[model samples]
Target: MKILTTPDIPIATLFQNMREVYATCNVDVSWASEEVLNLPALNIVDVGTCILGSTTAEQNQLFTHRNSAGSNDIVIYFVEATDPPFNGCASHPLGMPGAVVVRTATQWTFAHEQGHVLGLNHVNDNDRLMTGNGTANITNPPPDLVASECNTMQASPITVNV
Candidate 1:
């Protein structure tokens, strides 16, 4: 994790929530390391609505800070904010598995964006983790991840057996 800005919710709280969510699906997730960045120029990134098909120069620059991360490792960048209407983004430069999260994100936002990094797409269900409407709209507490989504996540190169 690379924190460009402090999030409204504590990172520990968010990670706890994520661990609980993924635990239900038998996928153990944990952060290997963290760093606090002082790049004021890249703090507030313009993601242009976070379309998964492309990336912005600002995002490209921001993501370059991944230090010594293996190709299969996923780097999570916590920024002050994305353009607007997006709390987090899963799009990355080709072959780089990464995601950018905003300071205002909900507890589940980190998990949702990481889900995308693991090849999961948005689903219409509000009770699920992959909801297209946003994490705030999730109707269920500790949003559910169905079997198929679990398979996709586990199959990703970023996932490894213990």
Candidate 2:
């Protein structure tokens, strides 16, 4: 879904970046729909709040309140600002199901948020996607995932259905 002031982001390019960001992971990355070459893909706008603060009327309460976000369906909400410290976030309240918020829609942002959707958490490794406050730089490598993380991600109910 499109958030206020984010229709101008380059979704196709950024999405590709996300795919590359998770290349090392066991999960596959594909557009939810066709490739959006336009500056603003979807025009429908709504409340696009960061994962850490969902108190606003627009943020998804189900995720923010339950203490579980980005554990379910990948809802990529494009907002207009980078006020939030994180580039993206998992949106699910139960089991990490939720939408991914992309202010800049960078490749790292997409992949980092997806990491959360896959039930992965942050780490101290700067070289990994799970690094605390994952980087948006394209030069960085993909997020790191061990056999266990891959197993957990692959076995998740959401991934299985996909």
What TM-score fits each model? 0.95, 0.63
lDDT digits (tens) for residues 50-111 of candidate 1: 87869999888888888867777789899987775489999998777899989999999998
Which ten residues in a row are the worst by lDDT in model 1? 78-87
Worst 10 residues of 2 by lDDT: 35-44
lDDT of 2 by residue, 50-135 (tens): 44334333344323332222344455555443334445555444443445454555556656666666667777767666677556
TM-score between candidate 1 and the true structure = 0.95
- Best candidate, lDDT-wise? 1
User: Among these predicted structures, which one has the highest TM-score?
Assistant: 1
Error of 1 at 36 (Å): 0.7
